[model samples]
Target chain A: MNNNPYYGPEGHGPYEMIDIGDLLLEDGGTIPNCKLAVATHGALNAAKDNAILVPTWYSGTSKIMEQVYIGAGRALDPAKYFIIVVNQIGSGLSTSPHNTGGAMTGPNFPKVRIGDDVRAQHRLLTENFGLKSLALVVGGSMGAQQTYEWAVRYPDFVKRAAPIAGTAKNTEHDFLFAETLNEAITTDPGFREGRYGSPADVAAGLKRQAKLWTVMGWSTDFFRANRHKALGFESVQAFIDTFMTGYFAPMDPNNLLSMAWKWQRGDVSRNAGGDLAAALGRIKAKTFVMPISHDMFFPPADCEAEQRLIPGSEFRPLASIDGHLGLFGTDPQMLAQLDANLSELLATRVN
Target chain B: MNNNPYYGPEGHGPYEMIDIGDLLLEDGGTIPNCKLAVATHGALNAAKDNAILVPTWYSGTSKIMEQVYIGAGRALDPAKYFIIVVNQIGSGLSTSPHNTGGAMTGPNFPKVRIGDDVRAQHRLLTENFGLKSLALVVGGSMGAQQTYEWAVRYPDFVKRAAPIAGTAKNTEHDFLFAETLNEAITTDPGFREGRYGSPADVAAGLKRQAKLWTVMGWSTDFFRANRHKALGFESVQAFIDTFMTGYFAPMDPNNLLSMAWKWQRGDVSRNAGGDLAAALGRIKAKTFVMPISHDMFFPPADCEAEQRLIPGSEFRPLASIDGHLGLFGTDPQMLAQLDANLSELLATRVN
Candidate 1:
C-alpha cells in the first residue's frame, strides 16, 4: 500500500511520533507496532503537575489544532502551562489504515475506540513524560470525546476537563451524521470495497461528503448573512468547494471510515455498564461542558443535559452563529470568549 | 427515450390533468404546452367562495398529500369545502423534467419558480374551476412556499393561509439542504447529465440521497425511540430501505432537480422589492404559521421569525420530536394537534 501524503508525518512540524509498539485496543484488536503523533506547547513546570492535554478533533491534526487555538496569551498558552495535543488513531500520521506496515491496512484495520485513544494517551504521558496527572484536559468535537474519556476512565489523573461543541455520549443525531459520512465514502465507485488505487480516485464520494458537511456544519446565519465573505470567499459555493476539496481530496477513505465508526460508537456510559449518569458521576474532575449556541448537531439543550449529570460541572454556551464549526476560532469574539472561559476553569481551585 | 412507470398517470386516483400551455416563468424561461395535475373533492358552491386550494409539496403527488393530511374529520376535509389539490410543476404528474414531451424532457426542462407555480395555479383556478377566490390556501414544505406566494401575489384571492412545517421565506439552512438533495441526484452516475436510460440505473446515487433524507427528514428521537419499530421495521435500515427505495427509486433525477431549484429559490420578498416584512404586510389572509418544534430544517424559532412579520398572524408550534417530517401525521398525537390547529384556524372569524 502506498502512503497517502495528506496524513503522513512529512509536513507535521512541531509534531513528533512516539513508538508505543503492539497496543491492545478496547475492542480486543491489536496493532503490531502502535505509534502516536503528538505535539507539545509550553514547558512542563518543575513540579510536573502543570501539564495540560489537548486531544485532536475529527478531520484535524495536532498542527491544525495548535494553529487554531494555541497562542502566547490564549486559553492554551504555551508559556503558562504545558499542553500536549495527541493525534488519534485512524488519522494517517498515527497507526491508521494508511500507515500500518504489514497486513493490517485499509479494511483490515481493526476497530478502535475513544477509550483506546485515552489509554494510549495515558501511556504516553505516564511512561514517556513521567506525568502523574494532567492539570486539565480539553478539546472540541471528537477531541471532546477523548477529554470525557480521560476524565471518566482515569478520574484521579485529570484534575479538570472541558468538552467543547461535543458530548460525552454520542447523540442519535451525531451517530446518524457519522453513518452518512461512512455511506458517502463506501458507496463511491472508486472505493472498490476499501481497496482504491489512490485517495484521489474516490473524489466523487469525498465531494458528496463535503456537501453533506456543508449543510450540517453551519447555521442559517453562516450562509444567509454571507458569512463566507468574512472568510474571504466571494460565495458560499466557492468556500465549500475550496474547503471540502482541500480537506478530503488527499485523505484515505478507509481511515475516515475507521474514525467515523469510533465517533459514532462513542459513549462513556458503556464503561459504567450502560449507565450514563453513573459514568458522569464517576468523573471526579472539575468539568465544564461548552456547546455552541447555533450548533445544529449538538444543541445547547443536549450539552446542558450531559453537564447537569456531572455534579458541580459548569455549563457555558459558546455564542456563535457558525454552528458546529464555530469552535475553530473563526470569529475573534468567540475565540476571546473561549480563552476567557478556559482560563477561568484552569484557575479554579480544586476542592 | 424510455417510459418510466413511477411518474406516468396510469393510477393517479381522483387526480386530473389540465393544459395551461406556453407559460412564462419568473426566471424568464417558458414551458411550452404547460400542464398541471389536479385532484378535487367536495362540490363548488354556487358563489364559488368555498374553494379551498391545497398545493402538493416537493417530490409529492396529489395522492401522497391526500394520504398524509386529507380525509374525513382531518385538517383538510373535502366534504365541508371544495378542496382542490394542485400538483406543482416539476412533479412528474405536472409538466416536469421527466414528463415533458419530446426534446423538452429531462435536462431540457425549463427552470420554474414558486412565482411561476402561483401564476399557473391562479390561471387553473380562474379558467378551469371558474373560481374567483379561495376560502383558504394550505400546504407544507414547497407547497407552503406556494401558499405564501398565493397570499402575497394575489392577496384578494386567498382569505386564509396555513403553512405547516414550512415558512414563507426559505432559510439558509433549508437552502443548503435543498442543495444537498440536488447534488445527490446530479452526482448519480446514471444521471449522465440528465439523459439516463432509466431511473433505476443510478441506484447508488439514489441510495446516497435516501441516506441524506433519512438523516435530515426525521428527528433524532424519531430513531432513538425506535419509532421505526412502530412502523413494523425491525431496524432503521429496514425502514429507510423500504421507505426511500419505495419513494425515490422510480423517480427521474431531473424532475427532482427542477423542484429542488424552485424550492430553493422560493422567496416572497422578491415581489415586494426584496423586502420580507413589506411582502408579509401584503397578506390580507388570516395566516397560521405552524412549524414543527424539533424540525432541523425549519425550526419553530425560524418559523416564528417569519410569523411575527405577518399582520395579526398566529404562530403555532407543532410540538413534535419528529423534526421536519412530522407534518406527515406520522404520529397520531401530532396529527390530532395538527387537525385541531387547522380546525381552529378555519373557524377563526377573519378580521
Candidate 2:
C-alpha cells in the first residue's frame, strides 16, 4: 500500500502474514503486534521432514530469494522440499519500521537483533506450520546469519545448514563499514534524524552510501576487469547511478537502518556466553560454511575461522568477483558452483 | 595563520616559499599567485648530483616527510644528500584553498593534477636551485603519483625514481572511492556547498569519511589482529574518534576535495595520448615501483601491471598490514623494509 514498490504484497507477490503478537527483542525492546511475512513453495509432507527454511538478507525479501535461489530443478528444489522464504523483521514486507503504526514507527522503531529474527521465525514454523524439524536451512549474507543462529540456537531442529557469503560473528571492520552507511543516511539535513517526509528527502545520503558500496561490495578485480559492462552498465558511474541506486532507492531508509544494526551485531556467540567455539559446538546439523572468494564483508578467512569451530562443517568457497554481493546471483558461474555445493550438502546423511 | 593546527608553518616546521605566480594547471585552469612550500636538508654538492626530491602525499606536508622518511643515517639521509621536500599544491602548507584569498579561494580553487604538482616542483628545482638532474625522486601514495609523473614527463631530469603504494593511472574503483570521500564532505548541510565558516562546520561529514577510512585505509588483518591496541586505542571506535578524526578535522574540506579530484584523475596516460603503456615506457630513469602487500587503495597487482611496462623498473612489494596507510610509517618493520629498498635504489648507478 506504500509508495515504496519494494514493500508489501505488490513487490513480494502472494505471501502469508503470521501475527506473532508481542515479541521481546534481544536488545530489551518489544515489537508489539509483530508479524512475519513468508512465501512458501511446494508442499509439506505428512511428517513435515521435507521442509526447508530460507531467510531473507539485508535489503532483500522472500521474492528475491525465490527468484534467485529456489526453483523446481535447483538444489533448493521446490518439487522435493517444501521451501519457506521468510522476510526478516525489519524488511518492509514484514511488520517493519515503515509498516508499523503509532510510537514504534520510522526512526522510533525498536532495535531488533539477529536473535529476535530467529525467534520470530521459530514461532512461525512451530506454531503455525506444525514443523518439528527442517530438512535444510540455507541463506546468504544476513540470511546466512539467521541460518547460523538457527543451527546453533535450536540444534536438533535444523538437520542441514549452509550459511553462504556470511560470518557467524560480524567483524569489527564490518561494524565500522555499517556505521558509514548509517551516517551516510542520518547526516543528510533533509533526513531530519530519519523523520524525512519521503525517502527522496535523504537522496544525497543514500547516493553517498551507494558510492561507498562501489568500492567495498564488489571485488577490486570486478571493477578492474570491467565486469559492470557484462551487467549492461556502460560505465562504473552507470552501474552506480542505475543499478546500485535503483536497488536501494525503492526500499525504506528506516528498514535498511534496522537491518544494518542487526547485521553489524550478528553473533551466535551470545548463546554460549560469548564463547564462539562453544556456541558453534552445540550445532548438530550438517553444516557447509560457504564463503565467496574476494568477499570483503565476510572474507574467506573470517568465515573459515568460524567454520573450523563448527564440528564437521565444510569450508566451501564460491568464486565470484562480485565479492559479498555474489549472493545476488549476478555471476552464473558462481551460482552454478553454489548450486552444486548445496546439492552435495542436501544429499548428505544427517541425524 | 589559520587556526587549523595542521596548516601553516607551525605544523609543517620552518619552510621556505618560492612564488611562481600564475602557474597554468594541467586541466586548463590557472593557480593565481602559485607558491610552492619547500623544506630542505644537507647541501647540494658542487656537482648537484647528490640532490634528491621527496614530494608530499595527500594530507601530508614537508615536515611529515622529514619526520617519517628522512633522517641523519636513514635511506633518505639528509646528511649525505640534498633532500628537498616540496609540499604539493592544495596541501595547506602551500598555496591552498584554505589559505588562498579572493576569487580562486575555497571551492573556487582551480583543478590540479599530478602533472601540475610535478611541474610546480620542477620549476622549484630547476629555476630556483639550478639543478641539472636529480639523484632520486621518490614518494609514497599521492606523492608516488607525482614521482611516476616526474619520471614520465621529465625523463632526463630524474636519474632514479621510486613510486610507492600508487598507480601511474588511477583505477576506476579508486576514482569511485575518491567520489565517496568527496560526497562525504559536500553532503553535510553545514558544508553549504563548500562555503562553511570553518572546518568544524563539516564535522559530521568528515567523521563519516573517517569511518570510511577505518574500513579501506588499513588492511583487514590489522583490525582482526587488534593492532589498534598497539597504537594506544583501547577500541576501534576510540581509534576512529581520536586518531582518524584528529588527523582530518583540522584540515579544510575544500582542500581535501581539490586533492581528491586530482587523485581520482591521476593519469600519466594522458601524456601519451591515453596510452598508459606508452606513457610508462617513456621513463628513462632507473625506476622502482613499490607497492604495499595489502594496499587496497593501490594493490600490488595494479602497481605491478604498470611497473611491467616501465623498462628496467623493478616491481617491489613491501610487506605491511597497515595497507595504504603504510605510507604514514606506523609499522617499524615496514619502515625498515622501505628504508632498505630505498637505500639500494639510491645506491645503484644510473646515467
Candidate 3:
C-alpha cells in the first residue's frame, strides 16, 4: 500500500496521528500498532462539552470534511466549538493495509467493523482528550454508519446525532452492490490475492471499480440533466475518464476491499438481537436521520423507515440530484439546508 | 458461445438458422457468412398478413421469448397468428463470436447495430416468408431497440409495434452502465484481450458482470420484498451464485461485449439527422410504448419522453417490483397485465 504514490507524502496533506497501541477487532483479529489519523479545529473549551466528533466515510479522510462542511460562521464554526474529524480504520490516512507494518499490512490486514472504529474514537476522546461526552456526533455514508454506532453503543455520551445518507442496517441490495465493488478489484489477476507489488499492478481493476461507482454513485437524473458539465467536465466520458478514475486511482485496493466488507455488514440491529426498532429505541440523543432524496445507496424511504423507529427523531431529507454523493457538498442549496438544520439541532438543548 | 455447455448442441433444444450471406455493418465492417438463428410458432394464414415478428434482446435467444411470453392462450398464440422470434446478431444462438469461424470468430467479430438486426429480419420476412407487411412487431429491452428501429426504418412493413422496457435513443446513463459491463469482462487478466482459451478462463470477469447486472436488473423493492424466494432462492447470495452467475457463465465474453456495444449505440434519431421527434414521427404503426415502472436500466420517464414523440402512441407502464426483469414474466400479475396490453395492442386497427 505504501508503494502507491497517491497516498504517499507528496500526494496528501499532513494530518496528526496517535498510536493507540494494539487494537482488538470485531472479527476476532488484532491490528497491532493501530493509529488514528486526526485533524482538529478550534479549542475544546474549559468544560470540554463543546467538542463535535466527525468520522470519515469510505475512501474519505478528515481534510475533505473540514473543507466542505466546516467554516467560520457555518454550523460547525471553529470559533464556537472544537471539531475533531477522525479518519476511519481502513481509510488510507489511518491504520490501513498500505501504512501498517509486518503481518498486519496489505492482504494480511484484519477485518475491522463499524463498532471497532467507534470504540477507538471513544478511547481517543476519553483517554487522550479527557472528554466525557460529545456535543454532537455526525458523519456521512460510512461515517454515518459510525455515527449510528456511537449513538446506539454509547447513547449517554452522544448529546446530538445526525447520520446523513446511510442506514443503520445495510440492505441486501447494498451488500450485493459492495460485493461487486470488491469483485471488480480482486478479479484483476493483477490483484494477485491482494499481494500486488503496487497500485499500478491493479490499475485495470481499479479503473473497472471506478466505472462501477459512476453507475450508482450519482442519481439517474444527474446524468440525464448532464450535471457533470457543472463539475467542469465537458462530456460524461470526460467526467468518467478524469474525475471518477482520478478519485479511485490513489487509494489502496486492499484497503477499499476491507472498508467495503465493513460497509456490507453495517448493522446496529445486532445490538438488540437483530431488532432494528429495538436498537434505535435505545438512542437517548436528539437525532436527525438525514437522507438524500436521490440517494440510491441509502434511499430516503429506507432512512425514513428507521427514523420512525427512533423516538423523537426527525426524518430530514436533503433534496439533490447528486444522489448519495450530495454529501460531498456538490449542491450549494443542499449544503445551505444542511447547515441550517445543523444549526437548529445544535441550538436545541439536550438532556 | 458454442464451446460453452449452456448453448451447446445438447444443451439448447433446437432452432433453425438461415444464411444471410455477407452482410455489411452500419460501422462499415462486414459479417462474412452471417446466419441468424430463428424459432417460429403457429402457421401463416393463406392471406399471409397474420404474421408477427419478435427480435431477441441483449443476451436473449428466441427460446426464452417463446417460453415466457408466448403460449396457446396468451397474446402471442400460435393458433391465431404466425409468430417469428429472430435472435439478434451477437446473441449466442445467432452469428456470435464463438459460433462463427475464420477471421470473424471470437474477438474478430465485427461491430453490429440494431439497424443491422432489423435489416436482416426484414430480408428474412420478404425473401423467405414472402410477406408484404407484419401484423405486429414486439420485443423487450435491446429487442425493443430493434423493434423501434424496425418501425422507423421500414415504417410501412410494421403495421403495429410494442417496444417494451426500452427507449428509441439510449440515454447517457444507460450508455455509461453498459460501459461498466464491457469493462468488467475486458479487465479480467484471464480475458487476454478476448483471446481466452475457454469460458472458464474468463469466469472471474463474467461473474463480476453478472453481479453488476443484479445491481440494476432488479429493483430495490424486489430484493427488499424477498422476491427471490418466489424464484426458489433462499437468500440473495444464493440467487446470485446460482441464478446470476449461471446466466452468464456459459456465454462467450466477446459476444457479450459486441452486444453491449450495439446496445449503447441504439439511436433511431440517426434516421432523421439526430431529430428524435422527426424520426419517431416516421412510424406509421399503431404503437404502444411499454416501460416497466421499476426498471432502472431504462426507466419509465426516459421511455415516456420517446413515447410522447411517436404519433398515435400510448404510454403504457408495467407495474412490477422486478424492475426491468419484469419482462422475464417473474410476477404473475405483471405477466397477466402484459398479456392484456399486448392483446389490446394487437387488436387495434392501423391505416
Candidate 4:
C-alpha cells in the first residue's frame, strides 16, 4: 500500500487522491474532469496480478468501503487479497454537481449513465495505478451495476465479477419509483424548478419522499416488529414528526433531487447501443449474479432474466425479508456465499 | 314478505329522489338534508324480525352493497333473509355535502361518525320500513366499522354482526395513512382550504390522494402482478394518466373530499367513551371479526388484537393478497369458509 499522507485527513489513512482530468470527454461536458479519490490496501505493487476492484454505491465513499477491507474472516480480508476501492463520480464526496467547478451544478447537471461512472473508475485504475487487469470485481446495488459495467466495458480487465441485488437492465418498475421521487422533488413549489426555494418547502418534499421510501423499501412485518421502538411516540403525528425530525431533517433538497435524477438514469444498456441482452452477452468475466428475493425495487426475477442472457453466469437468490436493504443488512451471509463461489474463479484467473 | 315498492328500484331507483328536510342535523350544518336512497331485497314484511342490514365503504352506495347481499350460500341470502342496503350518510347518493340543503355545501358540511351513519340507517329501517330489529348486521372495510357500531350503539337491535377487514380500534399506522391522504388534499393550492377552487386543483389533489391509497392499500406483490393490466400504459406518465382519469372520471371533488374526511375521523370508540376495547366488549350481538391477512391498511393483526377483548367473538383471517379489497374478490375457498361459520351462527339466532 502507498504511504500517501496528503490523500485524506492528517494521520488518517494510506488512501491516495488521483486526478483524472485526462479522461474527460471533450466540449467541457458536464461529465468531464471525473477526478476520483482512490484507496488501496494489502499489496499495491502487485496490481497487475493481485488487484481486486471495488466501486462505491450512491453516496458511498472510499472511507466507507475501507470498512470491508481488513476485517477478520471478511470477504476482502487484507491478509489474503489486494483491494482497490474507487469513489464513483457524482457521489458528492467525489467529483459531483456540488463541486464541478462551474460545470454542472443544480439543474444544469447533465444526465450520467452507469457507463460514465465505470469508465471514470477504470481510467483511475489503469492510468494511475498501472493496473492492467483485476483478480475480481465485486459490488452491491449501484455498486453491482458498476461491477457489471467493468466486465462489459473492459472485458479483458476483469477475471471474476459479483453483482449483488441488481440487474443488467433497468426495469419499468424501477423507472416508476424514480419518477415518483423526482416528481415529489420537482413539483414542490419550494423546489423553484430545481433552484432556490424555502427550506420548509424542501424539508416537506424530502419528508414526503422519505416516507414513501420507508414504506416501499421495508417489509410490513419489519414495521410491525419495530414501529414502536423506532418511533417512541404512539400517535401517527408523532411518527411523522420523528421521521421528519430524524431522517429527512438534515438532507439538502437539491442534493436529494440530484441523487434521484442520477438513480433514474442508471442503466448500463443506455450506453450499450440500447441492446441490454447483447451487452450482457459480451461480459467475459466469470459472473455471479446475486438477487434478493423480496426486493421491492429489483426482484429476483430481474436477476434471473439477466442471468439467462449471460451464458455460464451463476444466479443466486437470497431468501431474506430485508428487501433491497438485504444488500447491506445481511452482507455477512452474502459475502460468505460470494467468497466461496469467487475463490475458485479467482484461482483460475488468466492474468 | 312485504311487496312494498319502497324496498327496491320502485322505492329508490338510480334516479329516484326523496326529500330529507327533517333528517338534517341542524340548518347550516356541514351536512345538507338530502334524500335517503333506500334499496331492499328479500322480504320487507319480515324485515322487523329477519332483516340483514348492510352498509357501504367509502365512495360506495346501496348499488354496490346489493352485490354482497347475495352471499353465496352463506349467512346473508335473498332466499332465506331480508336484506336492507342503506346508503351511508355523506355518501353523494345520500345526505351529503354535495346536495344537502343549500346550507350544507362544500366546507359547510359537518363531519359525521360511524354512530351517525348507523343512526341514519336505523331511522330508515324503522320509520320507513317499520323494522324493529335486524337478524344480522354485515359490512366490509369502513362499512364494517358501521357494522361494529350497530352492535355497540344499538346492542339489542342487532342479533348478529359480521365486520370484514376492519377493527375495533384504528392503529397509528392506519391514522398515518389517512393523515397523509388528508394532507395530500389540503396541501393542493387549488383545494382552497376545502372551498371552491379550479377544477384542475381539485382533480390534482384527489388524484394525488388516490395514488397514495393505491400504494398503501395493496401489497407490492399485487402491484407487481397487476400494475400493467390495471394501468395499460407501460410508462409512469401512462400509469398516472390512467389512474387520474379513472379515479375521478365520474365523481365530484367535493363528494370525494367529504367522504375521505369521514374516513379520516373513523373511530368506533371516538364517542364511545374513548375505550375501544370496552366498547367492543359491550357489544351484545354475536360478532364475527374477519380480516384480510395481507391488508396493509387494516391488517389482520389489528383484528386479532380486538378479538381478545370481545367475549364469544370469533376471529377469521382471510389469506388473500387483496389487502383491504378481499371483501369483493370472490375467492370460493374464502366463501366456503364464511358459509360454514355463518351457517352455525345464524342457526342460533333468535327473533
What would the per-residue lDDT of candidate 4 be over residues A196-301, giving only the tens digit for each residue? 5333656666676666655555444435555434435564356556743455544445555555555656666655788887788888888878887667677787
Q: How far out, in Å, is residue A241 in model 2?
A: 0.9
Give every collision pair in model 3: B1-B98
Badly placed stretches (over 4 Å) of model 2 are A1-3, B1-5
Give residue A47's lDDT in candidate 3 (0 to 100): 91
Q: Cα lDDT for residue A133, model 4?
A: 82
Clashing pairs in 1: none
Model 4 interface CAPRI class: incorrect
lDDT of 2 by residue, A1-351 (tens): 224656768778789988988899888878887899889999999877999999999998898898899997899998898999999998998888888878888988999999999999999899889999999999999999999999999999999999998888899988888888888887877888778877888787787777777778997889888889998999998999999987777667888899999999999999999999999999999999999998888888889889999998998899888898877888999999999999999999988
Query: For model 1, what is the error of residue A61's alpha carbon versus the real structure, in angstroms, after optimal superposition?
Result: 1.4
C-alpha local distance difference test of each model: 0.84, 0.88, 0.88, 0.65
lDDT of 1 by residue, B174-256 (tens): 88788877777777677789888788877767777877788888876677667778878887778778986667788878888
Locate the minimum summed-lDDT window of 10 residues in model 3 chain B: B1-10
* TM-score for each of the candidates: 0.92, 0.97, 0.95, 0.76
- Model 2 / residue B35 / CA error / Å: 1.2
Give lDDT: candidate 1, residue A4: 77
lDDT of 3 by residue, B203-244 (tens): 988988888888889977898888998899999888888999
Instruction: Give lDDT tens digits, candidate 3, residues A165-221.
Output: 998999999898888888888888789999998878988888878878888889788
